[model samples]
Target: MYPTNIKMKKKDKRKVAKAVRGAIKAGIKENIKLFLNTKKFGRIILAKLHI
Candidate 1:
């Protein structure tokens, strides 16, 4: 019973870690995209840009 409890705890920890990592990655990607769009749009005309 003790060993099974320990294994369950470890699994839970791993799941939480994976979720946190994914959220961080998504946030970083959004920030980078926003930064790039802001910088690029500031310097170029909207008509010439291609996403």
Candidate 2:
């Protein structure tokens, strides 16, 4: 959740939504690959999203 002071107008919200969609479409595979390669404490995090 964002703070109340950070108010987003409808137009700005639409632009952000469009950019996020485009980024996800273009970089989803690369993002997942990078995430999987990330390591902490000699262990890897395996995440599953249930839709």
Candidate 3:
């Protein structure tokens, strides 16, 4: 993946964008799951209650 910075053909533009978006979304999902295992979610709930 190091060479992903290389120029991609116009025909592959959408495909590459889709792949990058999919990868970023997947990474975010993983981080969210990991965070939920800690007490970060409790803080969010407490803040909501205070409001």
Best by lDDT: 3
Give one digit per residue, the lDDT tens place, for model 1 in 16-38: 99999999999997786666668
lDDT against true structure, model 3: 0.77
Q: State the lDDT at 4 in candidate 3.
A: 66
lDDT of each: 0.74, 0.70, 0.77
- Tens digit per residue, CA lDDT, model 2, 2-49: 667877999999999999999898798667656666865222444443
What TM-score quantifies how close candidate 2 is to the native fold? Answer: 0.44
After superposing all C-alphas onto the true structure, candidate 3 shows an RMSD in angstroms of 7.6
Error of 1 at 44 (Å): 8.3
Give the higher-lDDT candidate: 1 or 2: 1
User: Per model, how many backbone clashes are there?
Assistant: 0, 0, 0
lDDT of 3 by residue, 1-51 (tens): 466668878879989999999999999976865675477785575557653
Q: In candidate 2, how many Å is residue 11 off?
A: 0.5
Of candidate 3, the 10-residue stretch with the lowest lDDT total is 42-51
Best candidate, TM-score: 1
What are the runs in model 2 whose C-alpha is more than 4 Å off?
A: 1-4, 29-51
Q: TM-score-based ranking, best first?
A: 1, 3, 2
**What residue runs in model 3 are displaced by over 4 Å at the alpha carbon?**
1-7, 40-51
